[model samples]
Target: MEGRNGDAVSLLERYLKDWADESLHAKLAQVFAATNMLQDSLSHYQAALRINPQNEAATADGPKHIETTLSLF
Candidate 1:
């Protein structure tokens, strides 16, 4: 996906529609985090956490993203 974050997001979102995979949501959240789409990233991060609170990626990275997004306001 060579920096094609949009493509990655589209793929993850498409698959997520059929099945709510925690890792997919986590990955999508990271992709959005890398871009300026903070809200989208936060949503996915929350989704992943909702599915599996023990998810290390979401637990670790989600708060950082949320804090960063919140700081923007």
Candidate 2:
């Protein structure tokens, strides 16, 4: 990303278009979080949970991260 000057968000979004897996969504959520795209991150996290209610990471950390992100706004 630093070398190519490419948009990481766009790349992730493109990958999502092809596959909508829970793990992929979780990964996208982390990438979005790293980029400060909180809303998008939260959405992906929620999507992951919707796909698999037992998703431990999303279930445990999603709400906390969402709260933290909203607090910034």
How badly does each model clash, as a count of residue pairs? 0, 0
Displacement of the residue 29 alpha carbon in candidate 1, Å: 0.2
* Whole-model lDDT per candidate: 0.85, 0.75
Q: Candidate 1, residues 1-73: lDDT per residue as tens digits? A: 5469888988998999999989999999899888867888888888898999988889895568577867879
lDDT of 1 at 36: 65
Candidate 1: clashing residue pairs, number: 0
lDDT of 1 at 66: 79
Model 1: ten consecutive residues of lowest lDDT: 61-70
Off by over 4 Å in 2: 1-8
Residue pairs that clash (backbone atoms under 3 angstroms), model 1: none
